[model samples]
Target: MTLDYRWLHDTVRDRFDSDDAMEAFLPRPLTPDELKQQGDDRYLSAMSQRVFRAGMKHSVVDAKWPAFEEAFWGFDPEKLVLLSPEQIDGYMNNDRIIRHRTKLQTIPRNAQFILDIRQEQGTSFGEFIANWPSADIIGLWNLLSKRGARLGGRSAAGFLRLVGKDTFLLTSDVVARLMAAGVIDQTPASQRDRQRVQDAFNALQRVSARPLCQLSAMISLSINPRGGLKFQTQRY
Candidate 1:
């Protein structure tokens, strides 16, 4: 049966504009004051990536996240580089996140690549992320394809776009929400792109507020099944 996506889109549109609206539509994370407070930490970006990965593992692919986490060193970029070939082979045979060998092998190299960018750019991780360089559709697609190391190419791209990667204009839940809200016609295939579109629509609606992390949680709650949104739920 075909799924209707209008309600999901509208819900995202209405809530993302304001904290209260978002809270009313979803759940609470950081209070208003906390969102207002800022530092040089890339905690939000890191958390967003984690959420994207976990969501891909659990919701999209029905994999065991806990095992994935345990096997992958908490998704730490630095630690991932240390994994041996045997470990990658083991992960392939295990019943965890997508066990694609190429994806697994790419983890460490990808981590190293990011680290190289971080050093070469002379920017903090947060700053580097905040200034992601993607202008058009192709650029965004390439950026996502590259960043999503261990995830499948299309899935990685979708996840990046969903989590507000600056290049693309798609996101899974955001597109679903947009479809639900009647703001758009077709459901975007790329989750990341869908999210970008939702953010753009939210901006047009004049519902801007601080604390995107909190809003992220709200978004997750609205779309993800119960117990599926928690970051640490899948204990390693």
Candidate 2:
């Protein structure tokens, strides 16, 4: 049976030492203007970091980010978009960075993708992320998967969370809550399942008057009490 968001939030609150502790644990949602103010290079860098972190040890990727910044020219989207064929080839043997060729190639391609968006929408990539409706976040995930390299499944959602875009990540804890609430019968794999998840979150957001980020955290805390599965919390 579906529970009211108040019940969910209280359940999470109960697990904490105090109300202040709960508040400190949850992330603050970014406003549209705040999101827009983030530089393009920061967005590109975050995207690339997420790409590299997938299926790899996050600490390892993070430890090498400085080399990545130096090698990739501080993740400047314009500069990356202008990368020469020779420069792309050189990274394969570069000892300074992770030499995974496929992931390496996505950097410039994603840079071009960012530039394309600016050209088409006349807004920065960060603004584009901020302007997307939270109610249709699954649709935003689909768009990112199609338009941005290496941003499918949870990666797109993770990227949104990383940038403080006020969206939810469909992590296992959230999925479990969704299933328990009768939102879905199984893991959300099909388009219909994804839509159901989105609708469920939209309903919760309306009922709770909470941003998707806090709602996601609430669901997670409700599941594991001590906190959900451990993962890297470092922001790009």
Candidate 3:
């Protein structure tokens, strides 16, 4: 009972008035070289931003990113990994940034995680991100959760999406469409359920020759019909 890829593409195209308009909305995954060129600072910043954005308004976090950049010393992986507990605790009192101590604590820990990747891979964290196969992106999400602090589930997927990695997001709308297509009985949390969802996306990607990001977006359009993502209150 998988949704037809052609049908999903057609439905999404029909939503827009013209072909060009629809084309503009389609997401394209970055190439390995392009992704690798982003450097560690950018990857660190993107990861930190996505972490802070969890369970909070994106615009509010985005508006304060400049202060974040300054406070975190431009998110340099080498610099952030050395951040002391006293410095991290000071952020709790800093009014310019989000004051959630738990979330604030993740920055240096995750920064060290990024540095570990560089030490092991002999390349920037961006290269590590770029090398992950899109077809098995769920595995990467699992790795992130296991290796990096506060990088499980939505945070991992959201970070990948933010960095233009070719991965599908399991947003509520996408999960609803998966249920309707008989891909899953409920929101995928367990490894078995998440693997099923990944397999479904892989099948669709094979049929359409599109990245998972595009397939995910098209599926959302097919189900929701109306455009724009409405944030759900619950963490998925």
Residues 131-177 of candidate 3 have per-residue lDDT tens digits of 98988999999998999889887888988888888888888889998
Across residues 15-74, which tens digit of lDDT does each residue of candidate 2 receive?
Answer: 777889777777777899999999889889989998998999888998999999998889
Off by over 4 Å in 2: 227-236
Output the TM-score of candidate 3.
Answer: 0.93
Q: Residues 1-236, candidate 1, lDDT per residue (tens digit)?
A: 11223443454555355655545544223332333242222232333244445435545532454555666656666666577888888877876566667656766666665567568888544454455433233444455456545444444434443334433223455346456545556865465545555454444334534233334343444565335324421220
Better by lDDT, candidate 2 or 1: 2
Which residue pairs does candidate 2 place in steric collision? none
lDDT of 3 at 56: 88
Higher TM-score: candidate 1 or 2?
Answer: 2
**RMSD of model 2, in Å?**
2.4
Best by lDDT: 3
Clashes of 3: 0
* Candidate 3 Cα RMSD after full superposition onto the native fold (Å): 2.7
